[model samples]
Target chain A: MRAAGKRFAGGRSHGDSRVDQFIEQIITGLSIGSILLLVAMGLSIIYGSMGIINLAHGEFVMLGAYTAWLLQSHFGLGLLASLVPIFIVVAAVGWIIERYVLSLLNNRPLDTILATWGVGIMLQQSVRLMVGSELRYVQMPPSLSDSTDVLGFSVSSYRVFLFFVAIALFAVTWLLMNRTTVGMKLRAIMQDRSVAASFGINAKRVYALTFAYGAGLAGLAGALVSPLKSVSPDMGTGYVVDAFMVVVLGGVQSLAGTVASAFFLGELSGAIAFLQNDTVAKAIVLLAIVVLIRFRPEGLFATRVRT
Target chain B: MSISRRTLMRNAAALGAFAGTGFPHIWIKNADLARAAAGEIKVGVLFSLTGTTAIIEESLNKATILAIEEINAAGGIKGSKIVPIVEDPASDPATFSEKARKLVVGDKCVSVFGSYTSASRKAVLPVFERQNNLYWYPTLYEGRECSKNVVYTGAVPNQQQDEFVPWLIKKFGKKFYLIGSNYIYPKEENNYCKKLLAKYGGEVVAEEYVPLGHSEFSSVINKIRSTQPNVIFSTVVGDSVVALHRQYRAAGLDPEKMPMASLTTSENEVAAMGGEAAAGHFTSAPYFQVHKSPENEKFVAAYRKRWGADKVTHFVSEACYFQTYLFKQAVEKLAASDITPPNIRDAVKGQETVAPQGRVRIEPENLHTWLWPKIAQAKSNGQFEILVEAKEWLKPLPYAAYPGQVCTEKGLVEKS
Candidate 1:
């Protein structure tokens, strides 16, 4: 408690400094939440439809980062321009894995976990062997490189852009799931595969497409994050753990729940970090989440679906 | 294009080998091993080549290999070529210990050179002690401990902070903001800074720690902004180094006005962060590639020639290069082919060498090298400009609490 108060009590007026630190923590929370939204959305979608726990989804993020690195290094493409290509490239790889390898272990949840874990290892090592294991850098866009002062506090424009990007991506995904034929088929298949097949919905095709789309979303997340963090082969491992928490705590099948959870976890962790040390903050967050899960085992807003 | 070029080089090497006896690459590897078994002395090269510290450790690996090549070309030590068996510890402490065991007990390496982080060094120390093997650690670290089985070729806490703190206090104001990644190195380093600040009539305004790989620095930046400290001393390593620097710049803080000082940011980090972000920051290190010495010039030329011109060298890598030469000098002092641990350790005591870092003499008392402390400023071109350098070698005091160690422009000596 003393450590927390000590940090906030600076050279500035005590109340003013505390207020500023709080506002800054909120912004940091939002920045973390946006990244979590992008990552966990894809993870939740895959888990909702396929019932497959993708341990390798984080590796997909690593792949997307590498794809962006290669494009920028080889063709002088900026971070924004490399996003679509990275999505396509990573989606195609995900599609191949789902069609040939994952299709074999569809109903076996335990096997899929081990298989994906193995795939993650393979992906990490392959990148290490090919790219030579060094931290690669992706330059931020020149336009968003500077900060914009808001109420006398300096705020990064890139972070503001990221928040907007997360909202836009979420809106697009929601529309795709609610207003389109693919969305209806995916929902039907998620609810009942046999019923969807009886209604002439191609469950197989939808499964592969949804998996690829999820992978693409992960790639997009990776591309967006590349400029902020150092891009390394093991970069995804940490994010995947955090994203899983976001998806689980948000209620795995509910997008709104995930969004809420992402913000909640981000803010809580950031605010706690502001007060306590980082390691203790992490412990408290995980402990709180664990207690939350004990009370609501299906998550905060999970729908009742009879399987 | 780089991958293809590497493939082409590999193919050409393969073709040249095949042209002689039509042997496969596997057989060629075996033949090299056979040669090593017959005449070469085996030395283990260990470094974190794949995980978080890979960026820095990979350069150290190349530096060690370059030294081996140079030594071999210079007609080998006592007519025996050195065979380096390289292994990647993958930046795990347990893996480091396991590999150290394998190198000593299994590979029969006479000496092992590696490790960047103090955690890894600590992990492998007991193994080296148990096996009666020598481990030459070549990274500047938060020092307080000395292992008889290990030879430290990098700057200790006193050697680094002694030069950095006073100069920083004089150049900047007296208030310091200390921040670091939550680990042994950073924790220890910040503690050292706290003590140094107190000694120099300076004070730490605030102290903060973030987890390793914690990319977000906005909260910490806000604190730094409000605290308005005169100097920001950072020991955040890996990706966090990039994040902190970027966020500090993005938060509208002028580097020239209230500059950041780091013990960890070398040329490797500066290049990764790009030159602009690191432009006005200060770094305390013993070696910089920009040093205009004949030894450094030759080292840079040979390294560029071997590893390509685009590749950059840093303090740790240069220290590793010097470590290998120092090892060779120690080995040369011994008679016959008795490369036993005790014999080598005894020979390395009080040994001196004119390395690329000027002059390094291993203190017999603590088994740590005496090095010249240098403070450099980062330039926009991803290089360092030496602001101040010690006039002479600073004697090794592994424990910072040790008093009566004195340094002058001419040399360093300790009072009995």
Candidate 2:
């Protein structure tokens, strides 16, 4: 019994102050919000340009996590080394899904939603059948495994890394959508597909690329978050719900809106959870989203368009 | 009732198949009954082969199969092979009861083994009771009731926390922060923990719950950090265990300083969260894979050989494996021809066996097993190092938390 206490370090408290607690909670919430943004950014992009609700977006994230786990576990690839490979692999999967399965359901919005959902379940079940339903873990990058002191409060350096990644992804996405030639073509298609097609934009190719990019972003989110959570076949569902919440609460087609709402909801839930508890926090946050949705059906940051 | 020619011919083929098993030509009225005596003894193996709980339950299913396979290889309880009719309840309570009904009524299994979650057990309870069939439940759970129709092979809260809490308080300090998945097992176990804590004059800094499958823990970790309790009494179950442990590590909260004393984390869970993720954390259970004994060594070796080298056997799977041997031992007492549910149930009442954990026996008084209690610190290799173990088997007390309630051989006995 005494031997059990061999590893027992003497106690020392950190971040006991109320101000410190507040600051820590804010950072924690931002970290969570950043994850939501990462997952939702691709969803918003796909929806904004294609008007295709890729319900399999979450599965893309799950696949990315699985890819990271696979690469690291089989090939001895570190988490950092596997990120590009994970993104590419998952994005390729997303590309095939879009070109082969989703493209057939194009004109039918309801069918596209249902088909993508079917694709999601198929992806989940295939993973379950192939890998088994056991929880899989991804190795954390050794460099960022420890906590860093911030404003006298300790915060996970990995989470801080994820936040920066989310910001960087958002910037890249912003540049791609606003400045790139692909962005011009995608915008033309979003505005009027026939006109874009008539203007030789090759609307279908552009749509597929946008879809693939969105999926790549979601996959990256999954890879980054994998170290913090267990990777399982159904891990995507928990994240997808929050991602949808972020996308819906943000204007459906707005990347900036997704970033704003993800943090807003995250901080709201985080602060509430600190004040009360998780159950109450979730209930209140969901209630707030519902009430907000009733007043503004187009969402908080609906893009103003002159018709 | 008149038998059609088609049914008669099918019965003839089945009878012929049974005859090939080398049994003497006994006058049997029903072909199905002869199938039990001469050919096979069918039992139900109900488990969640798919769904949320599959991560843990799948191993339990494998353990059950491994035990059954071993039994069959050793001539199978007086020459009749034990055939398992396995079904996946998919971790749903309604499906558990539904499949339990089908396994008992439709498949005509002599006895059934299943259920992990308390909700599924409760759901499955009524079907077994109504059918008067035996159900073997092999998962540690919150104890509050004793049913005549079921045999419990896992530890209850009393068997788990009775020794654990005091040891934690003595080793650490009085202040404990309680957290768990929002479910009955955790809630009930925490009730027992609180009761014990209060009796021991320990202080509860805070208590909280996360929803099932909830993976985020930064907020909860923040609370733990601010409170700075000597111990975190965690009952958090399922995949969320991995998340909580990983996040706890990432948050720079040293388990060595304020260790998570878990009632739910076992070797299988530790396997999911790498050893480093929860290295210094503690778990209180009736069994761990690293339990040393000839019986345990053989069981672990055989289990790994049958499954994979990397596959782990935890408290639940150990119970699941030994309980099958218990079932076989009970079934062997009665003649193969007379192996009915009631007979099996009666025979299983006082059965004792050497489990991977150690020597264990079912308490005839309550139908719950007498189990060894141990606290273990997780090693970085995903194996647990035993810290403290009870000198002898702890008695099962399903209704101990409730003063007026007690479970006897007959059933629940209440006092005003």
Candidate 3:
């Protein structure tokens, strides 16, 4: 025991004031919000376009994390380098699922929900069987692993990277949905599937592609967040609930609304955690969500659009 | 029931096939009983193979399998083979009870060995009692539980914190902070810690709990920094253990200044967090994979050989292994050849075994084990260097007395 004491340097408390701690919590909230934004963006697109909630969206995120883990371990790729493969692989899985199982059940809302839930379980169990149920770690790249002192607030460089990555993914997704002809077709289908089909929009193909793209975005979210936390099959379970909350609260039809709600919820929960305990913070957040939804059933920014 | 001519002819063909394959004549004779005989006994091995708790419970499952294999290889118990009927509870408490019931009722297992989380244990308690079956739980848990149908092979709070808290107070001062996952185990354990601290004239600076799997620890970490407690007594379980340790270190809080000690963190968690991440952290348990002893050495060698070189076993797994041998020894010692729930339960009372950790004895009174408590400091290699160990096995207590007798003695405590 004495020998062990020698190995440890005596603990000296860091000079962190209350104001600094508050700033740190804000940053933590923003980082968490960014993750929520990335995950919710995909959910918003899928729900808005198809009027079908993909409950297996979280499993897609789980797949992305596993893809990153596999690439990093097998190919010796950095966490950043593994992101592209993760997105592609997860998107491909999403495409196959959409083409096969989901396509047959299109327009059957209740069936879609239950089927996707089953799909989610299958995916989670499949991953657990493949990887073995143990927490796997991914290292933050050495350059991004250290903390950077910004305005007397010690900010983790990895979180800073995650914030920017979330933005970049959001921006790319925004451009893809707003500027592309495919985006136009998806929006057209969202408004009226029969009208869009009559107009030669190929609604089936558009819906499939849109769902796949949403899944890929979720995958991207998973890959980015994998380094900051332990990777496991069930890791996506927590994120999915948060993602759904963000999408619903933000207005499923509005991407900007989704972004806004994600940040709001994330920072709200984080800030509350600083003031109170985690359980209390979580309870208050849930209560707040319920009250808000009660008043604004169409969500904060829902247009009078059908979706 | 009338036997069909086709069924009789098929049975005859199967028997002829078995005879042609050179199966023993005894097997043919016992075909009507479906191979049930005095030479075979079935024990259920229940564990969470999937879900949240699988990280720890899976290790226990593997260890249980290894123990069964070892016992079977050692000429069986009085020439009677121990057949393990395995079931996956999937980490749900209700599922634990359901699967345990299935193991007993459906598979007809004489005894069941499993349950990592206390919730699961409690869930299956009624099932075991109803079925009149024995369930050997193999994990250190919050005390205040004792049952006739259950044999606890792991240390309770008394056996562990009795030695651990005093060591922390003696080495590090009385100012302590507490944190844990919001659950019965951590809540009860911390409640015990608080009483012990009060008795020892120590101050608890702060106590906090995060919901299970709440990965955001930045706020809590900030609280610990401001408080500057001498030690952070932690019972954070599951994946969050990795997050808290990583985030704590990442926040530049030196473990040397105020290290977090936990009853929950084990070798498996240390391995998950990486050696350097949780380095300087302390854990109190009856067993660590790196323990040095002839029994441990042989156990580790065999475990690694059977599992993998990369796989690491912790206290939970070790306790499960010990329970298997204890059951084997008890059953062999029984005058009767049949291994029933009542016979095994009675046989296990006061049964002693030189387990891998040390000599562990099951108390006839509470059904908990007399375990040797040890405190270990984690090294950067994901292995714990044993810092201190009990001079003798601490007696098991279902509801521990504050500042138990063994903890009152100082000379018996070793520094290194």
Which structure among the candidates has the greatest DockQ?
2
Task: Name the regions of candidate 3 deviating beyond 4 angstroms.
Answer: A1-18, A304-307, B1-36, B401-416
Greater TM-score among 2 and 3 belongs to: 2
How much is A71 displaced in model 1, in angstroms?
1.3
User: Candidate 2 on B1-416: residue-level lDDT in tens?
Assistant: 13344765776587568756653324322334442655689899999988888888899899999999999999988887999989999898988987888788777788999988999999999999998999999999999978999999999999999999999999999999999999888889998899999999899999899889888888898788667799999999998899999999998888887999998899888877888997999999999988899998898899999988988889999999999999989988987678889888999988999998889998998899999999999999999999998999999999868989999987899989
Residue A260, model 2, lDDT: 93
Q: Write down the TM-score of every candidate.
A: 0.90, 0.93, 0.88
The list of candidate 1 runs beyond 4 A from truth reads A1-15, A304-307, B1-38, B402-416
Give the Å shift of residue A27 in candidate 2. 1.4
Candidate 2 overall Cα lDDT vs. reference?
0.86
Per-model chain A TM: 0.93, 0.92, 0.91
Global CA lDDT of candidate 3, please? 0.82
Cα deviation at A118, candidate 1, in Å, is 1.3
Can you write out model 1's per-residue Cα lDDT over B158-205, one digit (the tens) per residue? Answer: 788888999999999998988889888888788777888888899988
The lDDT per prediction is: 0.82, 0.86, 0.82
**Top of the candidates by lDDT:** 2
lDDT at A227 for candidate 3? 66
Model 3 over residues A144-181: C-alpha lDDT tens digits? Answer: 86666555555677777877888888888778877999
Model 2: DockQ vs. true structure = 0.33
DockQ of 1: 0.26
Q: What lDDT tens digits, residue by residue, belong to model 2 across residues A139-222?
A: 899899998766555679999888899999899998998899999788878778898899898877887788788898889888
Best model number under TM-score: 2
